[model samples]
Target: MKALAGDLGIETAVSFPGRLTTDELSSLLGTAWINLHFSVAEGWCLSVMEAAAAGVPTVAYEVPGISESVVPGTSGLLAKDGDIGDLTNRVTEILHSPQHWWASSRRVVESRGWDRVAEDWERYLTVVFSSA
Candidate 1:
């Protein structure tokens, strides 16, 4: 990945701070412009819902479990599965179109009540990660 970035003359400034705390993740979500989910498969992704809760729109593939979280034009943009070109276009569209981004963020925020979801998430995470 680093080699490709360097070869393409791309200044990859982002760093992977391993294992973020809840506070750090929350802080990131608050400032994030958009959430990008490239997971090949997920079971009702919490990250997607979390992004909606923070008023951050999402760009992801149109897959089963993920589709439940992202409401296409309403909550976020979705690309065709395994299509990088489509994913790039979706991300670009969300970034360039401010009104769409605003509408998505507003709709996501208006439609979801995250209080109960958050509690469920904590419990789910605990159980899921305990044996990981």
Candidate 2:
């Protein structure tokens, strides 16, 4: 990737830091400019959601899982599935606009916190068992 970019006269340096520990992951989210989630399949992307929580925007494909966390054009930008060119464009779009960082972060509306989700689940189970 570096060689390709260099060949194209692009000066940006890209690094892929493989699997980080929990603390490292947290730190990365807090400090990174953006999260690019390219997973083809996901139930829902915890990383994407966490990025949102950390006020970092994401660039992802428009699939069921990623869609749950990334609100297209708000929290982040989305591209049609398998459209690498579109995804690249979206990334460039976000990086070029300075205010987009704040706007995307502020616009992210988390669906629910883990505590709330757990509470709702417990309440649902209690009601179902009580009726049974």
Candidate 3:
């Protein structure tokens, strides 16, 4: 992770296994942090969802599952799925361009709250109950 971070010109602080618990990870992510999870592919990745819930914008590769998870320019920016140059450029943009990055952060704040998600669920449940 450090190497990947360095290649992207971002400094990374890693906690060895057992060094950080879930609360610590949450706290670390709760700060002014930009989370990156550039997996080649994923299936309903919780990290991306959790980061959005924590109000942290993300940078990820443009792939099928990831695409479903992150809305580019809103929750995060997408780079070429397997191209290092594109990844570097996107990461650099997030690191150096505060406005674009914060736009994503604000997007998260605008629509990713628990209240918003719960409301969606409530609506679904209401329809289901009424139909039943």
Candidate 4:
């Protein structure tokens, strides 16, 4: 990986933190401009959710679990699965325009969180109990 980065004239810093605490992960996410989720298969990617919660948009493939969190052109952009060219273009688009980046960031920050989810769940439970 280092060799490939060097060949591409990119700098890379590899780390093996092993396990990161929630606070540590949050701190790392806070400093990121964007997050890249390349998972071909995932189950409700918590990393992507955490990135959104931290106001960091994502560039991800249009796949299950991931699609639920990243709303294209709102929270971030999505590319066809396995399309590296489209993924690169989407990422470049986000990086090139500060206005677009800020818009996406704001959208992500304003999107539903745990509080809203819990409230919705409570409402559903109440309706179910009352019906019964």
User: For candidate 4, which ten residues in a row score worst on lDDT?
Assistant: 9-18
C-alpha RMSD of each candidate structure in angstroms: 8.6, 3.8, 4.1, 2.8
Predicted structure 2, TM vs. truth: 0.66
lDDT of each: 0.80, 0.80, 0.74, 0.80
The residue pairs found clashing in candidate 4 are none
Model 2: per-residue Cα lDDT over 101-122, one tens digit each: 6456644644466677888899
The C-alpha local distance difference test score for the whole of candidate 3 amounts to 0.74
lDDT digits (tens) for residues 55-125 of candidate 3:
66678888888887887777777888888898877777777765566556656655866788999999999
TM-score rank order:
4, 1, 3, 2
* Model 1, residue 85: C-alpha shift (Å): 1.2
Candidate no. 4 TM-score:
0.77
Strongest candidate by TM-score: 4
Lowest summed lDDT across 10 adjacent residues in model 2 is found at 102-111
TM-score of each: 0.70, 0.66, 0.69, 0.77
Stretches of candidate 2 off by over 4 Å are 1-12, 16-19, 106-111, 115-132
For candidate 1, the per-residue lDDT at 48 reads 87
Tens-place lDDT per residue, model 4, 7-73, is 7776445433568899999888777788899999888877877787777788999999988878787
Residue-wise lDDT of candidate 1 within 1-132, one digit each (tens)?
567767877746644556888899878778778888998788888888777767778999988898888988877889999999999998888888756675567666565667656878899999999979
Candidate 4: residue 103 Cα off by (Å): 5.9
Total backbone collisions for each predicted model? 0, 0, 0, 0
